[model samples]
Target: MSTRLQSTNIPSIHVVIPGIESLKTSLESISHDTKFEHEKDMMFFRQRGKILIDAMFDYHPIHLMALFLNPRTRKMKQCTNSQRQSCLEYIKQEMIMFDAFDSDTQS
Candidate 1:
């Protein structure tokens, strides 16, 4: 009788967040395998990125914003009705520049 031993190599992916809790949370959210096929999961990450972008604009935290907006993170999806309304209010309050641009262009 002959015996064979098999070995498998798994590559590691690192996402570095500033705090340990955040790092742990991020790790918990993702899979080790690259094949994350769920469309809803992908959309969630994208929405998260948009939220981070908005936070950055409000707080002026460029690095955190950049990390969130990274293409590797994910593409954003349409927000739910409540989230959309909240975001609209936030934009009106904090993103007057964008609103002004829209208004000027429409005239």
Candidate 2:
């Protein structure tokens, strides 16, 4: 497990996010010898990873905007129409708020 997470790069989100479903499937299919001393711990890890990946499907719109705007995920095939709209609105509101702040600071 330590070997699996040795590398971290933000740009890898483009590759990782798109393959989450397949990774979840692989996690769900994991099986170890029942007699192993740490079998239960291994199973727990698999279950927890699956749960987190599944929850990513319906994550907050703002959280998803990063995926949507990423060059490698611009198609946003994973997101529903409503999620896209929510992200758009969220960005617009944030832009307006930031503009107001910028003007205030300038004054």
Worst 10 residues of 2 by lDDT: 1-10
Task: Score every model by TM-score.
Answer: 0.22, 0.54
Model 2 root-mean-square deviation = 6.3
Model 2, 35-106: lDDT tens per residue?
A: 788878888999998888787664655556776777767777766788678878888898999999999999
How much is 20 displaced in model 1, in angstroms? 13
Q: lDDT by residue for model 1 over 1-107, one digit each (tens)?
A: 01111223431111222232243345346455766678568668756865665455332233333334446532212223553355445546656887888999999
Q: What lDDT is obtained when candidate 2 is compared to the true structure? A: 0.69
- How much is the lDDT of residue 55 in candidate 1? 57
Which residue pairs clash in candidate 1? 46-75, 46-76
What TM-score should be assigned to candidate 2? 0.54
> Among all windows of ten consecutive residues in candidate 1, which has the lowest summed lDDT?
1-10
